[model samples]
Target chain A: MLHHTLKISLVAAACGLAFATTANAEEVTTERHQAEITTVAEGLNFPWGLAFLPNGDALITEKSGTLRRVGTDGVISTPISGVPEVVYKSQGGLLDVALDPNFAENEYVYLSYSEADPAGGPGNSTAVARGKLVGNNLQEVEVIFRGAPKYESGAHFGSRLVFSPEGYLFVTLGDRYSAMDDAQTLDNHHGKVVRIWPDGSVPEDNPFVGQDDALPEIWSYGHRNVQGAAIHPDTGKLWTVEHGPKGGDEINIPEAGANYGWPVATYGVDYDGSIISDKTHVEGTVQPHYYWVPSIATSNMIFYTGSEFPAWQGDLLVGALKGSQVARLDLEGDRVMHEETLFAEAISGRIRDIEQGPDGAIYVITDDRNGQFIRISNADD
Target chain B: MLHHTLKISLVAAACGLAFATTANAEEVTTERHQAEITTVAEGLNFPWGLAFLPNGDALITEKSGTLRRVGTDGVISTPISGVPEVVYKSQGGLLDVALDPNFAENEYVYLSYSEADPAGGPGNSTAVARGKLVGNNLQEVEVIFRGAPKYESGAHFGSRLVFSPEGYLFVTLGDRYSAMDDAQTLDNHHGKVVRIWPDGSVPEDNPFVGQDDALPEIWSYGHRNVQGAAIHPDTGKLWTVEHGPKGGDEINIPEAGANYGWPVATYGVDYDGSIISDKTHVEGTVQPHYYWVPSIATSNMIFYTGSEFPAWQGDLLVGALKGSQVARLDLEGDRVMHEETLFAEAISGRIRDIEQGPDGAIYVITDDRNGQFIRISNADD
Candidate 1:
C-alpha cells in the first residue's frame, strides 16, 4: 500500500541523449516540485509497451513485433526470441505488455498486439498472448484472446490489457474503423472490454456469460478506441481512456454489462464537421467520468501507486501520443479535480507507453523509428 | 434593456406539429422550472437565424438564401426581397442575424452568410451585410464584412454576427477547413473575430488596425469555426463558440490583439485519429473559458437576460446542431459553474439559433428542410 501527499508535477523539458551523459540531472520546474527526466535507454525502434520485472529489469515491446529487455544498469538486450507474429500496420502492431500478478512464481508475461486472422480474413484484429519468460525468450506461448469481426481498415485496434484485482484479465478492444456502427451490438467484439481467466477461458462471472445473444467474455460494450486502461487502487475498478472522433476523448470507469454509447451518443462530430449524433447523453449509455474536448490522442494511463513521487500517489497519469506529453490528473474520489501536463513538448515524438518502475521512478517510452526510454523522478532524489 | 434572472432550462420534448396544434403547452421538467415548448411557426426551410422586431414580429433567415418574417400571430410572410445572394452549402448559407443597437431609430438589420466570391473564385467565404427593414423588403442592402482567402471546401464557414455595447459591429469567422494553418498567421481573416463600425469602417482601436501585414479588422485570431457568440451583460465582453475538429469545441472571450490557439494549441485531434497538437496550453495564447469533449456541435449562443427564467439570469444559453439541444451553462463571474442540457432530443432537428424576446421568453429556430420557430416559457405563463 502506498500513502503520500498528492503533489502534482506538471510539464517536462528533456532532450534526447544517452543515459550516461544525461544522468547529470536535467531539471524542470513544475507546479509543485523540481523534477528530472533522465534517459534510461535509447536506440530502440517504435517502443510501444513497457513492464518491470521483479529483479528491477524492464521488458519493452516494439511496435514492429520485437521484445527487448533493459537491465537496471541500462544495458539493452537484443530482441527476445519466440514473440508472437504481429500485424504491424497502421495503429496496430505490438501494443501493451503486462505481467501476471503472480509473475514471481509463474514467470508469466502477456502481450497484446494486432493479429492477422488465422482463417484468411480480409483484415486484422487485436489479440492477447501469454508465455513463460525463461532466460531471454518467451516459451510455451499461447494466444489467450482475439477480437472478433476483423475488417480491412488499418485503424482503431485497441489493445491495452490490465489485470483486475479479482485476478481476471481485462482486454480492451476497438471499433475497427470500418465497423464502428457495430460497436453497439453485443454479438461481436468490436468496441468492447472482455474479462477472462488466466488460461484464456471465459470467466464464469463475466457480464455477458449467461446471455445468449451477447459474447460470453464481454464485460462492457460501446467503446470507440480504448488505448489506455488501469485499475483504481482505492476502488479496485477498471478505469479506461478512449479516443473519440474529432474531439470527444473520454475517461470511463466501466461497470459490468454497461453500454458506453459510441456512435449513438458522443460529444464529437464526424471528421468532416458533420454531426455524428445529437445526443451526448442517452438513458442507458454510460457517460464518461471525464472527457477531453479536442482529444489528446490518449495512448495509455495509470493510477500512480509508486512511492517515488509521494505527492503523485493515487493520481492518474495519462500518456498522450499526439501532444507528446503526460497528463497528471488529480482526482477526488471518482471525479477528476485537476489536470497538469507533464513533459509537454519536452520530449519530441509520440509517447507510446508509461510505467512506474520498481525503483519508484516513472518510465515512459517514445514511439519513433529511433525510440528512447526515459525515466522521471524528483530532482532532489 | 433586458433585466432579469437566469432560470436555467434543461431538456425538452416538443413533437413537430402545426403552431395551433402544439400551442396547448407541452411541458418538460427542467432543473429549475417546468418549461413549455410552444411551436410559434412551422414549415420554414432550414431557418438559421432569428431576430425580433419592435413590432414583436420576428425576422428569420432560411439557409436557402431566403429571409422570412413571422408575425406575432404566427403568420409567416413571403421571403424578404433584396437579400444577398448566398452560397447555400454544407455548414454555410444564411447564418446569423442581429439588429443595430439603435434599431428603433435606424431599423438596421445585419445578416451574416456564405458569400460567393465576386471574382469567380473557386470557393466562397463568410460575408456580413446590412440593410433597412421596410415592410417585407430589405432596402439599400450592402455587404459590410467578408472573410478572406476562400477555399474550395464547403466546411467551416463561421458567420455569427453581434453588436457591441459601444455600437461597434463584431463578426465571427472560421478557419475554413482547407486553411486551418492560416489561423495562426495574421495576414488573413481566416479563423478570426473582426470589429468594425456600422458603416463597415474599421475601428481605429481594433486590435490589428495598424499592425503590419495583419488584417485591420481582426480583433482576435486563432480560431476554428465560430458558430455561436453573445455579449455578457455584466462584463460587456464578447463570448464565442467555435467548432473544433473531432472534439475540441470551445467558448472563448475574444480580447483585442489576443491569440486563441487553433491549430497550435487545441484539445482535439484530426479526424483521422492523428495528433493535431499535443499542447492544449501554450504561452501567449488564450485558453477557452469553457470547452466540450466529444463536442455538442455548438451552433449559436446567447447570454440569458430574459425575465421569464429568473433562476437563469446570468446563465449562458447555447444552441447545439449536433445534439439538437440547448446547453444552459451556469456561470459564476467568468467561470462556468455548471451545465445542463435543455431539450435533448425533445425537438426534431438541429437548433441553429436562440434569442431572448422582448416578452422575456426564450426563442429558438430549428435547422432542417422543414424547419420550425419555437418559444420556451414557464408553463405557468
Candidate 2:
C-alpha cells in the first residue's frame, strides 16, 4: 500500500517498539487439539452466515438484514420473516446461509445478499435467495442469482454460497471492490464463480456453458473476493476462501473454466500497499490451494466432517475476518498440510460463521454489533 | 442501508435481544462531567494523527507509517525520522497531524496521507505533506497537496487536517467511497474542501480561486467522508465532521463555495440501507450544523478550548469510530445543544485522535492494532 507503508516505517524505526499484540485467549492448547470456548448464542447482529437446521436450529445471517433462529437451547429466534432487502453498507449485508440438500423435503433457504440495483442501476450487486422455510417465515421468496455490473462500493461483497454434491448451485462472486477489472472479465458477474440451478437456472455444465464471449454462469474466473465456500467431504471439490489485498488470502479449488488470478496474478498487495501483481505466478493462472500472507480476513469454510475434534477429523474450519481466529486447515488431498489457530485467545470478535453442529459442536458466529453465538468444544472433553 | 436494515430487523425482532452494549467506562459521571481516564501512552499502531509539541511533545500519527514522539513524560518516541510514505490500506494511513500556524516560526509539520497514483495512474488520492520538525527528525520534506481523480477503493479516505483562522490549510476530502458521483463534481478533487498555503500555495481567497472549471484549491463542495476538521475558536468558522451512511453523521458549517448535499441531499441511508436521497433539503444544498442518528462513527474534533474542562469550555470533543465513544458536543452557536457520551464506559477502543493537550490535558488516541495514547484529565483536578 505505499510500499507497505514505507516498509513499516523503516521497520518500526528499527524496532523501537510500535506495538502489535491484539490479544486473544479463552483457552487454546493446540498440538493436535484443546479448544474450550463457549458463549453458545448471545445476541447477534453483524453475524453474517451460518447454517445447520435438520432441526438442530441455527440459521443466523444478520449483517443487518436479519434472519436469526439460534436455539439449540441458547434461545435467540425472532427476526426471520420473508428476509430479502440488504445492502447494509461497508461489507454489504445478509450474506451466506445455506440449507436444502432437500432440507428434509425441500424446506429450502439459501440467501447471500448485497443486491440493490435491480436494474434501477446506480450500483450494488451480489444476490442469491430462494426461500421456503415457513413457520418463522420466508415462503416462496426466490431471487436466486445476481452479481453483475453494479458499483458504488460499499466495499467488496463476496457473498459465498456453495451447494454442489451435484446439486450444483455454488455462487461466490465479489470483486465489487470498485470492480477490480471485473476480476478478469467474462461478460460480467464481477469476480465470477457462478454455477447455479437451485432454481436460478444456468448450470449446463457451467464454466461458460455456451460462451458468446462468456457468462453462462462462468464457474471460476479471476476471483478477488470469494468469502469462503466448501464441499470436500472427500473431494466433491469446490473449496474457495478469497479476500487478499494487503496480503493475499486465497484457497481456491474451483476448476471448471478456471483463471483464479485476480488483479492479475496477485499474491496480495494493494489496499494502497499498491503492487497488485508482481506475479504470484501467471501465464494461465490457477494456483493457491492455500495462500494467506498477512491476511486472516478469510471468512466462512467448513469440511471437518463433524464428530467434535477427533483430532479434528478431516480438518479445514476457516472463518477469520481479519485474523480474529478459527483457521484450522491441515487437509492433505488438496494440500494445506498444517495450519491451526482456532479461537486464538477465545473469540475476541469477528470470526463470522464457522458451523459444525448436529451436536458434535464447533459453531461460531461473531462479526459484531453485539454478535457472539460461539461454541468450540473438546478442551479434552 | 436497506431501510436501516429493515428497521433494525424489525426492531431486533421485537427486541428478543440482539445486544448492543459495546461496553466502555473507566469512570464517568457527567452532570457537569467527572472524567478520569488515563493510560497515558501504551504501545501504538493504528493510532492516526495527534500533534502537540510546543514542547509538551505529543505528535503521534502511525496508521502504519509511523511518526511517534509521545512524551509529556509518557515516553513513546522511536519512529519519527522524516515521516512520509503512506496509503496503508483500508482508511489509508498516516493521516491528519498539524502544527505550524508558524509552528513557533516555522518548525512546520502538517501531514494528512493516502497518496499513491502520482500520475503513473491507477488509483489512490488524498495527500498533503510539509515537514521540517528537526528533532526526532523531519527536516525539509515537502509533497504539498494531491487529491484528484484517483479511484481504487480502500474505502472512503476523507482525511482531516485543519488550521485556518486565516493561516489557511484546511484539507478535509473524501468522496472516494466509489466517488459518490464525485461528491457533486467540480472537476474532481473527489469530495472537495481545499484551501491550502503553508507552501502548498493556491489560496488567493480560495473558493475556486480563478475557477476555469474549478479546482484552484477549491474549499468546500458536497462532502461525504470528511473525517473531522475544526477551526471555530470564535466563529472563525470551518467546523466539519462528515461520514454518513446508515444515519448521516455530519456537523458541517463549511461554507465558501458551500454545497454540502452529498450524494445529493442526504441524511444518509445507503450502507445498503439504500435511498441516498429522499432529499434532506435540496435547493442550494447546505444544512446540518449537527446530525447523527445511529452513527457516532465520527472521529477527531475539538473546540473545547481546554483549561481542564471548565464545564468543557466551548465544548465539542468528538472522536468515535463506530461509536466507540467520546462525543461530548453541547454547543449552541452552530446549534447542537447537548450530546454527552465520552468514553461511554471507558474507551473500549477505536476513538482515533482527539487532542487539546498542551497541559490543559485531554489527548486520546485508540483505533487499535494495540493503540492507546489516552489522557482525558480532571477527575476533580
Candidate 3:
C-alpha cells in the first residue's frame, strides 16, 4: 500500500512537472501496482455519461443525442433506437444515464437530456425520462422530471441523476444562463437538486414540498452547474462536483433545503474580472466541502467502493474537463485530506465522466469530437 | 454613434448576465449595428492563422499542418504544396503566416510551425521559415529561426509573427510547458519574443544584442503564451495578447527586454487549485495594459485602423477562445477606456484568429474540427 501511494504521488507530481514542460508530452502512467489502461471504445462523439447493466454491458450517452451500448469485449452497438430527440446545441443534448435500482425486474433505464421548450421559447430545459429497454431500443418511455423556467441558453443543463438507497431519484439542474438568481430561488428548478419518485412524483417529505411559492421538487438550491453526482457508499449521502466560472469549482454534500451560495458568494469572479461578491462566505449559505481555485472544469464523479484498488476505496474520483485529468480526492470523514491527479498525461482530452466497472476496474469517458472510453485496472490481476 | 455605443453596451451587458446565469448558454448576439455576418469559407479543420496577399487572395494556416488560399470571392484553393512537415500536436502545428515587408519584390511568405526535434527527442520547438510562393507551391524554403531547448509538451507554442515597420520580424514563443522558469532567463528562447531580419539573422538593434550570455535576438521576456500580436499604427510598437491559465489573460505593450512576469507574478492559480504565485505584482516586472480575470482564453489580435468601422479606429480587436466572442478594447492613450464584447451571439466555437481585411471588414476563424471562416461587415452596406 505504501508503495502504491508513492507511485500514485510520483505520477501526480510528474503530471505537474510534465504540464510545466512539454506541449506534446505523451501522458506517462506510473506504476501503481502496475495499473493497466485499455481502450474500451473509440470514435465517440463527445460521450457525456455512462451506466452499467447486470449483463456487464455499458450504456453510454453521447452529447449529440445518441445512446450506445459497449459489450464487455469492447464492441460498441449502434445508436439505440427510440432515444428521445435532444436539443443538441452547445453543451446540451443527451446527458446522463442510469439503471433503475430494480433493473433485473423492471429493465427500466433513466436518462437526462436538454429538452426543447414545448412553448417554442428561445431556451431549453433539462428533463429526465425513463423507458423499458427491450433489446437495442427503448420502449414505453415516459418523461419523469422537467426543469422549470427554461431560458434560451444552450449551456449549463446540469442533469446528472442518482438514485438514493430509498429509491428516490435526485436530479441535478444548472442555473440557466441569464437566470443565475434562480439558483438562489425556490420558485424555479434551475440550479437545484430535486428529489422525486421513479415515476416523477415529488416525495411528500421533500424539503420544499410544503412551501407555497417554492417548487416542491427542489431538495437543495444555489448550485452553479452540478455536472457530477454520486451517492456516498458509506454514508448514503449525495455528493456533487460543480463547474465554477474561472475558478472555484466545488464539491459539496447538498442537504435538504440548503443554499449553496453562487453569484452571491463565490471564490470565483466574473469572466470579465468583475467581482461577483464581496466575500466567499455568506450569512445563511453553506460553504463547499472542497473547492478548486483555478478550476479543472470538473465533470462527472463517483465514490469508489471497488475492491480492485484498495488504496482508492472511499475516495471520490472526479473527471476534469479543462485540466484533462481524473482527480482523486482522499477524504478523512467529510473534509478532503488530499487530491491526487491521476492519468493527466495518459488521458489526452477532456474527461467527461467516470465509473467503477462491475469487475472493479475504473472507466472514464473523454469529451471530444474524437472521444474514447478508457478502462483502468490493476495489471497484477 | 451614440446608438451604436448603447447597442454595444447592451450586448456586453447581456454577456455579463448570460455568464452569470447559464454555464452553457449560446452567446446570443443582439443586433446593435446593422452588421452582416457571412460565411467566407467552411469545412476547415481548426484554422489557426490568416494573412492577405496583394492579389486579393488570403493565405490560411490550419493547425493540422495544411495551408490553403481563399479567393476574394470565398473560393478555397487546394492545400498548397512544399510546406515543411510540422509536428502537429496539441496547441502546436502550422500556426501564423505573414507576408514580408518587401513581398511584392521578394515574393516571400513567412510561416511558423511546431518543428519536430531533429535529435529525435520526444519534443518539438517553434520554428519560423520563409519561402517564395510560386503557383500554389513554396520554393526555396529555408527555416530562419528555431526555438531553443525544445521540451515535450504540446500546450503552448505561441507562434504569432508580426513585422515592424522597420522591416524586422517579431516571433512570439511560448513558455514551453515545463520551461516557464526559462521565461525570466536570458539563456534560452522559451516564453520570449525575438526580433530578426527576414533571413533569420538577429537585428543588431535588438535589446540583448550586446548582452553577455543572453540570446541577442530577445526583444522581450517573461510572456506565458503570446498568441496575438500587432504593431501599433502610430507608435509602431509591438502590442500583444497572451492567454492566462484561469484568470489573468492580458494585453501588453512589450517593451524591449522587459519582463512581463509569468509564474513569478501571475493573477491565476494553478489548475489544481494551488497558488502559482504569491503576488500579482512584483518589482521590476511590467504590468499589463489590460487584463481579464476568470479568462476569456484570448487568441489572436489586430489593431483596427480600418475606415469601415470609423468608431473602432485605433481600438484593439481580439479573438476569444473560451468566451466565444470578439473583444473590442477601446484605448485612451495606453490605458483601456472601455471594453465591449462583439459577435458573441453570431460566432460559435473557439475564435482562433482575427484579421482586418483590405475592404476594412473583420474576418475571424473558429477553432473547431468543423471550423469556418466568417466575415463581418456593416449590414447596411
Best by DockQ: 1
Q: What share of the true interface contacts does each candidate keep?
A: 0.00, 0.00, 0.00
Second chain of candidate 1: TM-score?
Answer: 0.92
**Among the candidates, what TM-score does chain A have in each?**
0.92, 0.33, 0.91
Candidate 2 C-alpha lDDT tens digits along A171-201: 8878877678878979888887888889898
Relative to the real complex, the DockQ score for model 2 comes to 0.01
> What TM-score do all the candidates reach, one by one?
0.52, 0.29, 0.48
Which numbered prediction scores highest in lDDT against the true structure?
A: 1
In terms of lDDT, the poorest run of 10 residues in model 1 chain B is B12-21
Residue B203 lDDT in model 1?
Answer: 88
Candidate 2, residue B78: CA error in Å? 22
What's the TM for model 1?
0.52
Give DockQ: model 1: 0.02
Worst 10 residues of 1 chain A by lDDT: A1-10
Candidate 2 TM-score, true structure as reference: 0.29
RMSD of 1: 18.2
> Which portions of model 2 miss their true places by more than 4 Å?
A1-218, A221-381, B1-49, B52-106, B109-168, B171-192, B199-207, B210-218, B222-246, B250-258, B262-264, B268-293, B301-381
